[model samples]
Target chain A: MPTMTDEQVRAHLTHEEDLSLLHEVSMKTAGVSRLEMCIQCGSCGGSCPSGMDMDHTPRMVFAMLRAGMRDEVLQSNTPWVCVSCYHCVVRCPQNVHITDVMYTLKAMAIREKKYRDVAAPEFAETFVEMVEKYGRSYEFGLATRHYLKHAPLRMVGMAAMGLGMLRKGRMSMKPRTIKGMDQLTAILNKAKEMELT
Target chain B: MSAYTFYPGCAMESNAKAYYTSLMAVAKPLGINLEEIEDWNCCGATEYVGMNLIPAYSLIARNLALAAKMGNKTVLSPCSACYLNLAKADHYMTERPALGEKVNEALAAGGLHYQPGSLDIRHLLDVLINDIGLDNLKAKVVRPLKGLRVAPYMGCMVPRPDYNNRWSDAEHPVELVEVLQAIGAEVVDFPGAATCCGGHMTQIGPETAFELIRRLISSAERSQADIMVTVCPMCQVNVDAYQGETNRHFGTNYQMPIVFFTQLVGLALGFPPDKLGFGTEITSTEKALARIGVDIPKPTEDTPHKQAGLPMPSCLRKNAKGKVQHAEKEAA
Candidate 1:
């Protein structure tokens, strides 16, 4: 995929133009009724730990979702960059589950294959993949794989810390596999099927 | 003695070994008995749920299901993310019948079933501070962490979205402070104690995560804290592991040490210092924890002591009304 140009990104900008996407998102998230009642108080933006990292602040993202700007909302980095701090959710006067809404948007973005920052999705995928595979994650292994896949140059910078951790026995060099992973697989498979319905 | 099924989470075995080790050291002293759940899997963290909800919850619920199978009603998780995810799924599955049915449907294939709300999922902090009571903790403090100023960093998850109203105040939770103080540490009024530490963003986007990490460290520093004590593994890893990178990113010389809350608790409990696993931190914790009598690594030529450090940046502090009040605004 080609890197998105600023023009291409700007062209996709949208507002509360439709109720369809908003309705869909609301159905999936708990305490979503407050999204519509959002006064755009900007309190969530103020409380956000990573607000500056996103192309759109969380308040604006909610507005965009209500505006029915699927293209813009799905293409946003807000959902991906949201650390699920709940600072915004806890602080929102409207009492909207802003974090849950972010989760809903993230699910939507993944399902639609829209990514504002591909590394976010990659990290989530790599992490979940490891958990699904071993029933537990190997930290150093996960970090090595993730960095190798996302930012190889950055791995060199992290080597010292990795070595430091390894020397201290703070990280595992090998994967830790649990027993009855087969049973876990059976349950997860059923879960996957259930999600489809 | 209350025996609870323990879910050590994935990090306990690997990255956050200090936390697991420290908790274990204090467990016997605190009269807490933890039976490790047989064949426990990952809690799926924050990532899996974003990928797919049902499977992720089922993945978390599977652990709950196993605990129930063991006839254990209380499951103790030391990691903040693990505790929250476990509580979240358990609470949601019960609250939403549809989700409950779907999760139970998945468990049925393994001849396992999780009837949400059957298990009492609690963070180790909750069990220790609230359950054990601060007075009992004071009784165990053989060595009070006197004259040590520590900032209580609870990260974002442990307090918020409180499924059971278990936490005191989500925005400004003082349980960590209460516990730390009971054990004889000077718990600073860290305004950003409950601030988000930007979990996996450090991996996905270093620049952004660094800023967030920088904010927490800076806030703690401004509060005149010697070290930052945290309950969450993610917060510890991000702040401790990424402190160097964050400093290099922001042109700052902050060397704050972030350690697990349980490690400090163990120290106060008079457990052998070695059992707490103190020296595993990437950032040197010697200077910060010296008052507590934990052996710290000798400072290298690079990290000097008794030197005046960079001034703390003026940042916004959370007011009583849950609004961010600027430092200057307060001062003026």
Candidate 2:
């Protein structure tokens, strides 16, 4: 992760590029405007289920945005903490588009190599890989791969659990792929082209 | 009669076979012809859009392109994730001209072009309530689910604030509840109906997934719902099959039967329990079915409903508050 002083963090946060992307995606998807509408009210912070676990509360993130602390905002562990529950969005008096902002910031953080933890992003990657390969999520494969990638030792315990499930017929060993793999491949490639540009 | 281009997604074929089976069984009685789009692909499920926006939307839009070409004005998706992706892509394309241009360019390579707003993408539940008309549905009841209490869980993807396709309030959507009641099932106004089931997260991070699932199931149990009815196969699998593991991980005991909306509809339509795919469920739907006096029979080849050619019952006619009027008014 990129390290920066308070002044540098503030400078990066205020930078035009950082703010522009955040503004763009929000307006494009949620029709939310004015990140400045946040009044630092505690409604969003209070309602967030994971608020206490967050280093920077949703309210604080908005405050930081107003202060133009782009680098600190991007590097902070705040964005990843949001569970996308829309609780903040529902309760926010300003309708400040908290979730969309978090999404954009996380994307920026990932692009800038400033993310704090790899858990959520890694999970997302595993999901994309499944779609790229099979055109669908292979549950058994995803479960095994997730453990193998994130917590290798957990596989031993999961294996025992898998055996138990197998005996009871709760789990299936065979992985199922979606029909029309070639068509799916073409779609994925098209998606990739858009991402590249 | 209603005709829709169908995007089954992947789960319908494998993990959620019961959902597909029940959907096919019940739809025929309602005169819903779900013509599958030819040469269709996955909607990238729940995760791809989060990882990469353009590719994810492109991936979803490819299916929409095919549905549009098949000359179907409406696309009905059984999976919540697929419904969300298709709706989101359609919303974004109409709202964002530049992105629409870029995606159209990509589709052009496949000899396809999607006109934004050319197709109305909807979930199966949306079609049932908005198109099939609950009043008409209420009249077709060969059997009514009078005593069974069900919590209608919409999961995450279907009703969020996206472009204008949001059919109900994002936090508390009761459209499914209204449909369940039309079928004579007691619908519970549960708290976690709109909660995420940790979806594909169950595979990538079981710990996080466990906590999320625990919260949802516990809430449903507390709400006193006997079984939870879902529109998404992914949600059904996560809540139905993984609840035991979630309980074990959290040291709590929950024996909730997670069922598809179609299965409950099938039961209410007087279809036998076996025909509704009740035997395949991890948690016994038998007791719930028994509550409504439905007996489980041996699995056999699904027989089509005898009452096939009847005109849609009067109650099913579009109401003034109906979705068709609402969309048409908006268009006018």
Candidate 3:
């Protein structure tokens, strides 16, 4: 894959629509009024655990939202770094829905296919694969796929560690399939439709 | 006279058979009827929703739909992953009508329709603590796990705030702690009770999962817990079955028996070793049970107290002073 340019990524305008939907949903679901409560305080950025990894801190994302800088915010790598630990939400003085906003932003970013690097996309891909396969998050499979996709060479080290687990019956080579897997596939399709729309 | 629709999920029948066996063994004595829902399926465990939220919730909702159809007010699940999936679906459906509609639409194909809030989704610990009542449990403890220190691990799914099913603070859940105390077990206040055990991550990426599992085990070890008690099979398997690998990966020596809450209940209920599936455990609970003076004899068909309606065991009778008085008030 070629290095995605700013203009190439900026052409995708659907993320703003996603943000709007997220805003609407967040308000209805969580009673979180993120759009109104943000005061440009920079508190969310200060408390972010992965702040250094982002080009724009969480607070900046909020600031950009206020400024209507849709393309810049959508194209940035900030949202993917958020681990969703809720630390920022707990520390926010204004009680902004920083984490929810981050999730929404990440979801939008994912939908737009504007991820700057492979990490977030790989993580999301592995997460979806686990759900599709097992109808639930298989943490072992998820971690393995994620590492294998993002950092291929890491597999050798992982294999060495897994060998010990394999011997002790901790790790199973075959994924356990749930009964009525077809019904589960139908559920995933419906969920995908809702998420896509 | 209390009965609940049971959703055993996949793990309870297979890898977590001990949890299922112990649960069945202990329930009848407490007069709690766990009627397995007919033609039940998996609850999508923890990963399904992460990958695709709609189907994951829908798959879980299918079980909830069956439970609702049976007209059982409370649907009890012993597995944490199943409990979380069911609870998350129920909560999300009630909270988000649009999402609920989408999920219901998916379920419509299967001829299943779930009306959110029609059924109460509860974890086994929730039933034991809320419905069964601690007073009754305290009265029935023939074996108080006194000398054995236990770390209560709730894992990630059961205590989260998502589906409004959480009974305690998500960060610091106390249902397990309260139950352990009722069984006369020493409950250790340990961190990571609500942390993820990396669930299915052990299969996908052993190194990452090991690191996460190591953190939880080490925290429990630091708190001086003799064993870890969990409500989820994934947690039990990851923590118990994977301890040796986790130890090898991290170069740490930690041998802690990970047991189901139901197994602990079985021990407290005076069930013998084989009945509670004690021998199946990787780390021996024999030493821990021995500390509590519960030297269960070898499995035998004609044990002295095999009959169902004998007066509570002598140890329990001694502790029953408080329980009988409480039961009398309720009866009145």
lDDT of each: 0.81, 0.71, 0.68
Question: How does the DockQ of candidate 3 come out?
Answer: 0.11
Task: Give the range of the ten consecutive residues with the poorest summed lDDT in model 1 chain A.
Answer: A9-18
lDDT of 2 by residue, B1-332 (tens): 89999999877766677888899999999879989998577776655655666666677777888898888798899987777678867876776676677777767666667888788888898889888989878888888889899988887667765445456877788888898899888888798888778665566556666887888888888988888999888788788777777877988888888888898888778787667667666565767777877766532322111112213454553331153334334423
Model 2 lDDT tens row, A55-148? 8898887766655566778777766666666667767888676765676676666667777678667776776787778766665566666777
Greater-lDDT candidate between 2 and 3 = 2
For model 2, how big is the iRMS in angstroms?
9.9
Model 2, docking class: incorrect
- The better-scoring model by lDDT among 1 and 3 is 1
TM-score of each: 0.88, 0.80, 0.70
Show the lowest summed lDDT stretch of 10 residues, model 1 chain B.
Answer: B316-325
Q: Stretches of candidate 2 above 4 Å error? A: A1-47, A50-53, A65-81, A90-98, A152-197, B204-208, B295-332
Model 3 regions more than 4 Å off? A1-192, B162-166, B196-212, B282-287, B293-332
lDDT (C-alpha) at residue B311 in model 1: 27
Instruction: Judge the docking of candidate 1 as incorrect, acceptable, medium or high.
Output: acceptable
The Cα error of candidate 2 at residue A40, in Å, is 4.4
Question: What's the lDDT of the predicted structure labeled candidate 1?
Answer: 0.81
